[model samples]
Target chain A: MKLLESRGLLTLALAGAFLWSLTGVDWGSPLIHTGGGAAARTFFLALFPPDLSPDFLGVALAATWPTLAYAVAGMTVAVLIGIPLGILASGTVVSSPALRLPAALVSRFSLGGLRAIHELVWAVLFVAAFGLSPLAAVLALGLPYGGILGRIYAELLHDVPPEPLRALRTAGASPMRQFLYGRVPLALPDMISYTFYRFECAIRSAAIMSFVGIQGLGYQIQLSLHDLLFRQVWTLLLFMLLLVVLVDQWSSLVRRKLAA
Target chain B: MKVAAVTAPAATQLAAEGIAKSYPGVQALAPISFTVSPGERVALAGPSGSGKTTLLYLLAGLLQPDSGRLCIEGQDLTAMRPGKELARLVGMVHQQFDLVGSLPVVHNVLAGRLGQWSLASSAMSLIWPRERRLAQEALERLGIADKLNQRTSKLSGGEQQRVAIARLMVQSPRIILADEPVSSLDPALAEEMMRLLVELVEDSGKTLIASLHSPYLIKKYCSRVIGLRRGQVQFDLPAAELTEAVLDRLYDLKAERI
Candidate 1:
């Protein structure tokens, strides 16, 4: 009875603390500011019936190349930089404490810092640094994608079976051999699947990061919205959605093949 | 028909001197000393958590004893790192089968030799010029040559054990340390496995040390039996001396003649 009473009291106290923490915060979003305080709700209705006009298809097509370029460039850089870092960071290849600890710390910090900053924020920084160029968009995607892929690769490396590793260890095989024969074979399928999945995500991130003058689908969407051409916005969105769907299907097929 | 000739002499294949291990609030093994000669098949029999597995790990160079020295084929393992060389010297079959489920039986068997091959050789062998000869030879030895391409998950418990045996055969280590290798199998399959294990040990003239719970199996297969109780050696004697009184004392059960 005493324990139950104490638990209830503790719960009540925690709830009070949570309520207190939210006391002075502004709940409304800055994105939907209403003029004249007349309960204006235009932005709420702005996204209504998501504009689908035939005339906007050309605009959408025009932006496709830039978006695709952003995604491809970003993911390539990510893969190039992430794979080695990830392998080094994982417990599979770097089993020694002296090596694993420092490698893990670096991988974690780099990935965490990259992921913490939104890609849009990264684009803003790149725009400020590199001027209004596609390089800004590419770097924006590349930095975060590299970080995310590195973490994923590390996880894949770590999840391989330990028995093969143990066998390799006992045979007086080198660490590199253990990784190549033992860890690589075990993790190949999952690693490939994850990389493709990340590529799909890169496509989505690439579109969003085009706000700083890289004429991608997202740029078209932003322009159409500013002009209140809801139909054009929907067309751009549909094109983006189509790319996502295509990549999704491709990745599913690849995953199934690898699994088989 | 020609039988496989014994390959080596009984010159201390494995020697452990004054081994001791302790975990937080648990004394797992204490000041144990033992040696296994080439061509000798020794069984360490005990109940759960009796330090049999720990002793196997220590012998296999999988774990370093807090205070002990280990030598396999006159090479010191106490100072050696756990890698390809150590793996080549000692082959271990864990109780859990430890077979990578998604991999084919052949690949699992071939894994035993991965430590011997160069990194480039092993990596390239993953796709092109696969070590078909080595894998087939291993499976053939275990009488599961047809099951080489089959996924390990599809195999029965007995088949998995055979695959493990095949892997050990391919590894061809100087010492074989198996921990509860047949605890999960039925009595018949376990016996068959023990027979194969003993035959392989004797054939290669390599040291074989296995941990088992079944006294009948141990007596039927191993000439020497070491009984451990509560992290200490209770009895180390020939199978003929494993009397009912000693068995009861080791297991703390009522004495009954086998």
Candidate 2:
């Protein structure tokens, strides 16, 4: 009976997904175009022997700074906004029942609203509103990233061991005091690790945001691709990969130190 | 040692009147009343699920009684907010050694005084630990002074337990509530920990209320015993009067069924 019940549920879920996919998609179209595949293969082959001209290299290096700066600035804003919102959403700091529910609901709703819009969509909206400034890209990255970080932060706070928290409460520590001394210290390592992961995501998002006229590696890649300069595109791609690798190395070092 | 009559009208160090606690489906602690004088060592002894932990939590002001009153140092607990004053008066040693494992031993010990410090001071201490000497002294008393800079997770179970005691020593509360503090230790370690705890409380003239599983340890260290069964106090007697027959009766499943 249980097997049949689970199978029925699985069937329903698959049918629902199939129905959903039917909207706005042309099912009659060929799944792959042979000509497009050849072009993609050509692009892949051009990845080797990338453009290393001094002028283009200088441009790539300059673009690298903007990408890193946007990510850092956006993440700085995200951390500032996320930590407080996460604490509010976690509902651990408040003791009074009257305040806890509303605080949790409001903060959670705001987080959901922010992250519901993808960073690219947010960038388009900000560009419309703010007229293509660096602020538009930064805000676009900050809002959605803050929402994701806040949600994860709330979960980390909630997932901490209750024994130490209970012992702090028993020692007559106030709710804020308990949170600062007992809860935050215990959750700090996990929070730092998650933030680093988010920072890597933010870098990728910043690169993508350049498509909306922001100045970064993505903009350079788009311009090169438009002129059919595959070599330049490959060079820009290499720069992006190098940036990600450096950040990944740094993150692992920090996490290893935390563990030790 | 003076054994003040349990009914003495004079204000005691700790008092509970009809204190009780209940969960959705279980009565974890039934309404019971007791008093402890200054400088007394009391042991709460019971089988599993006999409300020993519940009672200790209530006394520590961690759990509010569904229906009763508690007074610590003659101040009503229910009327006042649990904060620095209450923290300064009551400390608890948990069975699980609830120190932050990633933090250094000195930081964990210094956390004992967090309630007493201003928010600014507490925040500053995270970067530049204030009162390092006090924390060092507490660790010295526990014979783990050299481990002060070591991360708490690196310590053994016994050393971690001693770090917990060092934290309590830094707290310097007049009343200490220990919830099965030695439950995780071996027999020899448990005995030594209990003896140290009793001696510390006695030397400082503090009130000690500890929930203990070992009848032998209770007889050896505690001045009084409160035997609980099924959320109620079955017997409250001087240690000398808590004989083996009393324990047998206290733990008898056959008698409980009847």
Return the top candidate by lDDT. Answer: 2
What local distance difference test score does each model get? 0.78, 0.86
- The parts of candidate 2 lying over 4 Å away from their true place are A1-29, A53-55, A94-98, B1-11, B253-258
Compose the digit string of candidate 2's lDDT tens values, residues B149-196.
888899998888888888888788889999998888899989988977
Q: Write the per-residue lDDT of candidate 2 for residues A38-65, one digit (tens) a residue.
A: 8998888887788899999998898888
Candidate 2 at residue B97, lDDT?
A: 81
Number of clashing residue pairs in every model? 15, 0
lDDT of candidate 1 over B107-145, digit per residue (tens): 777777776677777777666636788879877877888
Model 1 — TM-score against the truth? 0.84
Candidate 1's C-alpha lDDT?
0.78
- Residue A118 of model 2, lDDT score: 96
Error of 1 at B46 (Å): 1.0
TM-score of 2: 0.89
